[model samples]
Target: MAWGESGELFAINGDDLLTLSLEDQTVETRASDLKKDSPQHLPFSGANILFDIAVGPDGTAFVAYYGNRQLLAVSPAGVVSVLVQSESPWSPHGVDVWGDYVYFLESTVGGRPRWKFWGKDRIAPRVRRVSVGTSTLETIYDGL
Candidate 1:
């Protein structure tokens, strides 16, 4: 769970994104029904597993969608939108917001089902960040 700068606490429960109030202790749904039904265009199949959430300065939550290999933004009013999506085989995870960028971790594999225990050295993990309002990604660290 992560506490937003705007006093809201964010967490991922199953496929749902939940926000909680510290003062009133109220819980609200930010997003839900995150699972995918059919394999259409994206590299992965099955349900969308939300990995991590980062609350932006404007109180919007930037979520790392592992199954879809994309970043999603949840507004303060609970509107969900895709921030960016990668056509590659990487799956995004571990998100945080700092300064002008939203930093996250990406696995070389697409999803958990496709993951293997050995021969993973060739599949390098990366620490990447994207500028707000742009889909352009910048690598902070690679081969980690």
Candidate 2:
């Protein structure tokens, strides 16, 4: 869950995006079944794994899907669009935004069973930045 620039709170509930109503303690579904709306097949078997969420200043919500290796943008009207989809071995995690770039940890560790990598070194962890405006992705740091 993450707070938007306008102080609106957003959260993912079982692969669905919901906006929390703090004033009345209500929740509104912004988007549902994200995997069904994805542009490409999300390479995963069980439930969808939504890693992180970040909201931009313009009220666009960013959702990081570990299983799909894609970062999608949900507009205020709940229009879903693929912002950046990594080719392979690079899934977006810990998504956040500052200035014009959305920052995240791009790693291959995602989609792997947690027990296998528990208490072990991550595989090729990287820091990446994507332009929120142009949707251009760039590697800020790679490897150790």
| Candidate 2 residue-wise lDDT, 1-144, digit = tens | 999866679998887999997878888998988765453535445424788999989988988887777888899999998888777656776789899998887666554443234466345577888898787879998763
In model 2, the worst 10-residue window by lDDT is 109-118
Best by lDDT: 2
- Each prediction's TM-score versus the true structure: 0.79, 0.82
Candidate 1 local lDDT, 1-144, one digit each (tens): 788987889988887889899899999988886545553435445535777889989888988887787888888888888787755766787899988898888777523444353455334577888888665789888663
Summed backbone clashes in each candidate are 0, 0
Clash-forming residue pairs, model 1: none
Would you list the C-alpha lDDT of every candidate in the order shown?
0.76, 0.78
Backbone clashes in candidate 2 total 0
Candidate 1 residue spans exceeding 4 A from truth: 39-47, 110-123
